[model samples]
Target: MSQNYPNILLIDAIPFQGGSKVATRTLLHELTTEHQLCIFTQTPQSWQGLNARFYPLYMPRWLINKDQGIIYFIKYLLIALQVLLRKPSLGKITLAVGASGPSVDLALYMLKPLLGFTLMQLVHGGVACSKTNARCLLRADSIHYLPSSRASMVAALARYGITDMMFNEPRFTPMLNGLDKSEWPSEALMHSSEPARPVIFWAASLLKWKGLSILNQALQELNASDANFSEQGFSANICYIQPKNIALEYDEPEDDSANIHWFNQPSNLDEMRRQSSIYVSTSQQEPFGLSTLEAMAAGLCVVIPSDASYWDLALIDGANCIKYRPGDSQDLRQKLEHLIKHPQLMISLGRHAMFISRNYHAEQVYLPQLQVIDSYLGAGSSKAQASITGVF
Candidate 1:
């Protein structure tokens, strides 16, 4: 690798591939051409195809749980120490440590000064108000947060007595998750005629906040309302990945409805989206809702909860998306029924959504943010500083 190319190291403590990891993967894919990239992750297999060096941190199921406080830290320390000993030159070569959240990479935060790397913190969800987290955020060279998380992040900082002056402009920036245009279907596929029976797609981790139960109730009601629901109602494709170590209020729905299918973390989710006509989001106050954005990009008429989330605010109901009352399964059922009754409206909404998705292409959305990262890495010219002031 050329010395002029900045070495960017991304730390991923999470073992599974969630929205946060997906967003990180998208950004890193875009950055491959301009910089030298490496990933330190517990699950290296998840990042197999990316052109980056990988340092696997072996973590068992017990040690990986966030609830294991001191034991978790000690296990991480032992594994990280082994890696450091093997690759001492990493300290001098790395230009920045990219953390997915405020405290996601706690070990990196502790070793940042010794390793001589700048910190770039990306807030994917609500900021936890804790002294340790506040200290990590304060030390970060740049903090990129979603618009929805701004209030919570500010409040968290305030709890630690951090003044407004300390967390302004270039140091703190708001960003949205973007879609990879190459991964989506062609325009022809996007504008294809509506399917004979619309496929209603719902995908997310089976966490309580994701509202799987609400979707189940809505689907059940929709089925019960019509005797020939299997033939007249939409075909439902429910895809979910069970989160590790999280307690759930209800088990997965066991409806024997012929039209409903349950998929457990399908590998070809994009293909599934391509075949679907409508995408439903049931998350409660989602921070960024990357899956919802991707569904829009895939030309699916999205039905999202009207909870003032990032997507709810970005998409106009009946124009690009349809919104139902938050936590109201009956309302959600009604919305689905309305769309089923009017197929053209669903097609129109999807077309409009596909057009809007172009503006959020990863290359266009992440360029300015990447410039800010490059500036800190001392790889780009002074134009990056101008981007810092203008972007946000």
Candidate 2:
């Protein structure tokens, strides 16, 4: 049965590791036992221990920094040539491009015709309207995008005068990120009694769009009126990863509050989630909130921005999660204070969130996606396209 499975070449050209990388790793881990896999990534160390064979692809620093003009084109051409040369060694395989947008995987799109391999394009973020991106998107054999990104993709395609018929085509599929159930903390730990002081967990990169500043302001305000919020007061665990390959104008100030603890890419995030009573998400219009899902799996009461993202749409305020007005620090502060005031509400919410998290177990969520990929590999393009109609 394993021998019958098709070969897969997963491309990871992005310079930095983020949620898309995490999702790709999960999918690769799930596939390792059954399928032959090869990964082309700049960070080979991160792909270590996975059964997939890794090929080191060096993305230039200038390119990572988003440098443009002739130099960028030259660098990109060199990278494309390198991939072209290595194609023979990879064999006949389905090329899986996991990119934040069409632009990120443009090289793969350029190579698709020459390589004659089935292309699976997975878009992890909003799609931008560009002729190049639209062309790449249209050429791909299969496109997997998050629900939140659907509108953006539609808008991007519309720029090329493409109709909504593409969306209804079997090739376009909407998917949500999933969590590995094995990595989740024990159910006992997740449902453990609330601590002396409710510990809130907030994790994300310090990118301007992640709303870290809003969280910072909310925490500062909460700490200032700690006595008015809760009898024991609230403690916080802020896990922030520094953004790579981007210039930032603002530096996150060090919190002087004793209750607020900061972690710079901690290795034990699952353990932190286990100890936390509440989890807060501050990202504005997040394509998909994987951290929030993980927090829910950890049985932490999740408080998220009411920004119509996947979590915001799926979770009900005061039921599974608390939703505050997006980008409003005061609203966030008020929501947190309410959670702190009612510890039992936190526990109830945590329980419900954990229950909801089961729906997104990695295997369950990815099975249909994997089936779609397999269909693409097993049949001709036309047959595969028709086969995917009901699979997703």
Candidate 3:
């Protein structure tokens, strides 16, 4: 309750744990130093800290339960308005959303005038893929996008006939995702700064688009090769973690890389990272794969899916990281076998990945976003009239 500090409302609309949650917390960690923060999240308090008043959807009433909740979003919409409206005396109100969702974003947009707050949205690949995100971009006072996402979003707005307005201003800006090393579970931290064996790591919430099918088929081919003879088989264990329900229900492929298995997301991600020396990302539209960065930061030899979407990530395929064909199972299998055959390749690639990953740590990535927020919240700069209005 510092009287001198201004108030800002940070909203996280998704009701679960994911990359968006990580981004929200990382930004809040730094922003709290200068503002009186109000975080509205659906994640239970046990999962992470809340610096300001935390409003979650975990009420005792079954109707508000996250399982199939629609009414609760409306409830939260009201609560967000209430929070902003409650204190007219507080100076310089700002509204920041973790990721724009229909329920929260629309409601807040309608209330922006009544509540007297400037709006900012964090666009995490959603804008490039959906028209809804384009609307979110147009309505907001400012936008924070991943380095790869900024160009795509600007292009999207152009397609919507917003070319001149969007490019002329700093409305949409690039901001890379970052990690707080200390936020990871202490027990899951690697015992030594070296890689562990018997586990190769892959994870994605959206399995279908992330190329999980291709991974299985490729690993299946690898398993078949192993079945032909003991000498031809692959080495190393692989663990794939899919966020529950988001993944397509895939039956276990036969023998099929019998070493590879999928499980619900782990409570401690560091433990998952520690148990593996190699990490692979099969996502096709990965604007900023936060998990990929985490694996690289953990010193894992990371292989990224070969596709144009990955271009801006600044990953060097042959040297710093490995790039496998987008959907070619055979190509993936060959790459896997090569890594299995050459242990030194894993070490070298892993070390380089770790070195390259330094440029994207939270300390480095979140600075631009902070500067944007600070400028928007500053008294004189933010008073200019918004060119775009009305949600689509």
Candidate 4:
């Protein structure tokens, strides 16, 4: 590590194939341009060519595995000391950490000297909802929230007397959960974009909170609707873009919608973008809807379940995007049927979504945020000094 550049340590579960991974990578790359970055991750397979030192903990494969394995338990204990020692000897050393789930948040918090380093807890929703997140926020030097628009986590922490410090206050900054626009094909490829059928995209892990089952039910309800049935000459042609296994699991059932056509596993990102006209996400407790951002970047109108925590960041009903009642199949059906029938509306929404997408570009959203980290690191540990008042 260079003596002039502030050395910052980032801790999170890696093997980053999802939105969290994308956001984390964007921030790391941004900071590395000026600061020294050291990363501690669960898996470092996907990290290549990044100017950062990586340490892998080798965590469990799944949520369930975290509870049963002796190796995981041992790894947890070792990670605490390893992470604790990452603090710099002089100036300010910053510690940025997050858990894939709530339990890990508590575990991460329990191991520390809060004052020796600037402690920041990054909450991505699922883990933030639990008692563990509450405890970590109460104990940490600062908290960096993914969805800055909401007062939920901030309110919850305030109730416990954990008010925001200057460095740790909640922010509405986008987590840089988007791709580099230049990496995509030219605008000419966008000319052929048209809704051939009701092409809907769902890109998320096959977890219960993702609401794939709810999406399936909503599609069935749309098929059963008299208005939707009569509008399409009593025949609805709906195409679903998802993973192969999930498509097989949900599409093969006897009650599955006959109008549904499944396109599983697009060869690449362009293929995935081309196969769909609209993007839909219904996660129950998303911290930041990265998939929605990606879809919007690909010029698709986004329809998100109203309950997702991150929706407050940019989504507005019938404005930039549309929202359905969370877990309400009928509401989702209504939204989908409307968009499918009104291609003009879809086009308008897609255009608006593209406009909204620009605000979240990694360069705009991430670089500025990383500047905050740079400021903190450059100023050194004085602002992070432990409060003597014992309140806030």
* Clash totals, every prediction: 0, 0, 1, 0
Judge candidate 1 at residue 372 and give its lDDT.
74
Tens-digit per-residue lDDT, 16-53, candidate 4: 34456555655454444456566676556444545777
After best superposition, candidate 4 residue 330: deviation in angstroms? 3.2
Error at 145, model 4, angstroms = 1.3
How does each model score on lDDT? 0.75, 0.75, 0.60, 0.56
Would you estimate the TM-scores of all the predictions? 0.89, 0.88, 0.76, 0.69
lDDT of 3 by residue, 296-323 (tens): 7777778877776643247888798888
The all-Cα superposition gives candidate 1 an RMSD in Å to the true structure of: 3.6
lDDT of 2 by residue, 1-392 (tens): 34455667666766555788777676556554456677777777656556776787876666665534566456556667777778677666665554556777776766777777778888888887766678878898888888888888888888899977889998898888887655655442536553777888898877778888888899888877756553357888898876666544334637546688888888888778788888899888998988888888778899999888888889898889999999999999999988887888988999999889888766667665677765666533221123222211
Highest TM-score against the true fold, candidate: 1
Candidate 1 local lDDT, residue 191: 59
All candidates in order of TM-score, best leading = 1, 2, 3, 4
Error of 4 at 71 (Å): 12
**Lowest-scoring 10 consecutive residues by lDDT in candidate 1?**
383-392
